[model samples]
Target: MPDEIYLPMYPGEDGLTATIRVNGHDFTGLTLELEVRARGSKNPVVLSTETGELSLDLPDGIIVHYGAELIEALPDGRQTTIDLFSVSGTARKKIGAGYITIGHAGHMLTASLSIVEVPGIQGPRGWAPLFAAVAYGDSVVMRVADWTGGGGDKPSVGQYLGPDGLVDDIAEATDFRGGVGLTPDISVLSTATLDAGQDADVVLDPDSTPEEPKLRFSIPRGEVGRTPDISILPTTTLAPGQPADVVLGPGSTPEEPKLAFFLPAGAQGLPGAPGEPLLLVVSDTVDTGLGGWWVTRDYHAAATCQYLRAEMLVGAATGVTLAVRKNGATVRSGIALGAGVTTITDLGLVLAKGDQVSLHREGGGTLAGPWVMMVQIDGRAP
Candidate 1:
């Protein structure tokens, strides 16, 4: 084996195939040692290969291919190329990272080679391409330092870097340009002033002690065909030592506020003003004689009135049928009074001025004593 044998190769391209001859004799199954070293690195990566048939009649030679698995084991940094060599027995030959070297007898062969660095396999956190693909317009959100008008600070209104790498000012206003503070003199005006041609300014002074402002509102005076409905207004304040006089407008009558009161038991309220007088047209009590039906009495109304009430008393009889008629026709009927029962019926009948009202009754079974029947009519002008 020679002390040092140089063999050219490429780093990032196809692996190299090396053929070694064993002096025209079969040396199959012979173990060979392979050593690889990256340029400028002291530590060398090592592997092993076995002799195999290099040609039909050259079974004594061995073949070796340089692959990426060996190159990736190098440290994470830059390297110009990798230097590799193999040793069989006492013979040694140098092979570049990406080349095919064939050795015969004492002569060595070399070829230009290429070497490529494979990126390390990583999980999400170690992905560099993912972070590189993200740009400003890609809507990638990240928590960054707050803007402080310093290097790499977030862009703000009127502050940006131009295409020429110079700091340029943006003319548009930003939402946060205003400082964090309220105005000292803030004035509020009613929208109604737009049409009324009146100006009302309510100023707020932040530096001084808070005080209420005086406010007054009124409707214009005019002759209105109908009264306008009352409206609710917001609470207003009055200035100190300010006198306010609230006079009712024309045709406006203010009534007394309703007072809570309780009426005593059986207390009579004040009678209302005189209305149409009520007259009793019929008032009579008679017996429903024996076992026969009879017409008790008839009364003609001279003025408009209503049938006010009727009282019937059946005396020791099974039952008594009492009825009332208007203008000789039955208007009210089907009133049955049980034996010894007294009942009062109030009828609300609107009668013209010339309507006649009559009372009739029939005794059930033989009525004893007098079955008193009384009917009364009012003179209400219905």
Candidate 2:
């Protein structure tokens, strides 16, 4: 019951077909209002009430975040809403022709807003610049109604079998075919569904059986981060010396932006000895190739791959240090706070496989504003 659920199997329920004899069809005469809402969205598209059903054909690239509803008008003119995912039987089918449906108390709702997959997008120019994002990260989040079934508000991301018939966290799946029966709680049947994750590489096999494959998957959103790998996690340690590098802006544009990180409080000071010299910088591109010199100040990589490192001061005032070996011996020496922005290669070390990373400051230490200043750490992919 987390905000997301995994559906390795289909239609959470077994032996349940598209139609169910719910409450003796009393809902057939009742007026139903259908609505769909994307997660984190303020808008909801109300489909229909007079017909007790609705079909939608929205343009591609729009992600249906979370939640869909079915409302019915009461005799007193009041309305009650039911989750579309949990609707059962014909009551569910009435929402969309080929989406998954569920019924509760004779009420049915469907989820079949087709996903528009933008295939074969490549080359230097694209909606996004990264080739990894263009080729590998592309995938679909499908919520469809099968001619007989398909039902779920949101697809269960990070859930599916690999081509090797094993549970893979990296394999891409393009389809979660079939119509599912919904439960009142908005959960999907696991038997016939696939939730594709980032790095999802897939090709739907042609169905040899009569059912054929029925799916609606579109590439709504791409993973903003890259898969953390061996190169990202170096084996050598990164030692911190002093002057935790942490400055966000210059390009910390307010709109169309995102940021997260911690910084020192005052201009100078610390808890145990002095805090680590941590640097976090954002750039339009990452240092290309191995041993690529990193921007010393802002340690986090932005605008490219999702690779980043944090530094801390080890021994207080020992070396102009950033990250200290709190428990681990890994350290990043120091920053050369020059007249302007300094790209100190020696200061910014590559992250080692066993190396530990974190802010140098101990518990109650100098706040960034209290000591230095607030630094920005944009979470951009390498």
Candidate 3:
């Protein structure tokens, strides 16, 4: 029943890490339990004891609400809740303003955190990019800020986090509490620091698509950071566990953005733009196996083909094996592969299938796709 402090953090950002100094083996024969919670639901909680590598993979669609509270039964049999409960980012708050800016970092960009007024949470709302449109070594930086920041500061506050939307700046909020002819109390939760170089700068793959954008980030198979917000829209919504990626080009390309996810058949509902097919990489960072890594296939390599497929995939230590399927039936197969001299793995597929293309490979055991994430039909349809 004592007081506790909750520290909120966002993904792709830093999380809370504290060192616990245990005196000599004085406490050897005791059992300790650590409980983690999500979304106010006390029903099922994640636990860890004697930590070496602590990890919690929450359900795909659910936002992570976590706290580590140590429970100890005193010698007298009374249970106590330790104040070790501190919450940080694995996800974002429900509502508020967020921002990201372009042309920062000497045109070298940087990103920062902005927590404005949110409906349910304490500070204001926040925002993150669905995927990293801007890569590291590029002038464009990304961030989460209030929508009301000065126009000049907007770009400074924005970032390409492979996140979904921007947070609204409350500085522009219209407060009704003020009497007639009063200015709104509107305030932004931004640090206005516009972090650069350290922790904020993003790195892009040299061989990514030039046409569309993929927000790339590192998903700690067991690591975590504080980038706690996302944009929700009627047309599109970005969520945790949904991979996001980015491509940094010395110059921009003409690629269009894409979206993909596990749906319950009719769940995709109807495409916002029916006639046009969509190809999207998950906003969540892929956990390539042990030593292996993944990067976007270099367009130059595929440019020689009649049509090219500049695809993205997260590789595992062993190398990814891919299989192409058509209309629910297996057709062609290829190794979507791990990082190497290969620019980007070419599905070498001809579109014509429209949006019927599908890709898949969940890295735990063996690799399997239905690996065709996107099947681009030849623009010159017969």
Models sorted by lDDT, best on top: 1, 3, 2
- TM-score of each prediction: 0.20, 0.15, 0.19
Whole-model lDDT per candidate: 0.37, 0.29, 0.29
| Candidate 2 lDDT by residue in tens digits, 1-382 | 1111111212312221122112111233323334544334466545443333432222211112222232212111222232332133455433311223333533333333321111222123322111111122444323222122233343333333344432335444333334565433222222333344633333333432234433333332433553211111111222323243333333343332222233332222212222333433322211123222323333322121112333321111211223323124434334322123223222233332333334332222221111121222222211
Ranking of all candidate structures by their TM-score, best first: 1, 3, 2
What TM-score, to 2 decimals, does candidate 1 have?
0.20
Taking every candidate in turn, the Cα RMSD to the unseen true structure, in Å, is 32.3, 33.9, 39.1
Give one digit per residue, the lDDT tens place, for model 1 in 1-382.
2222344333323454444333334434434344555556577656565422122223644344545555454334333333444355687655324433333334334433332211121122321111111123423222222244343333433233333432333222122223556534433322222324344444433444334333333323333233223221222224322322122333432231111111111111123221232321221223445432344333333343332333333224455566656666666565565533232324444455455556566435434432333333444321
**Candidate number that wins on TM-score, 1 or 2:** 1
Error of 1 at 130 (Å): 99
Measured by TM-score, the strongest candidate is 1
Of models 1 and 3, which has the larger TM-score?
1
Give lDDT tens digits, candidate 3, residues 1-382. 1112222333322332322222111222222223322224455333333342223322111122223331111111222222122223343222111221223123221112222222223433343223233323323334344345232333444432322444344333222232457443332222322333334323344444444323334322323443322221122334422433323223322232232333111112121222222233333323435323222221111111122132333222244454444334433444344433222223334334232444444234443321323222221111
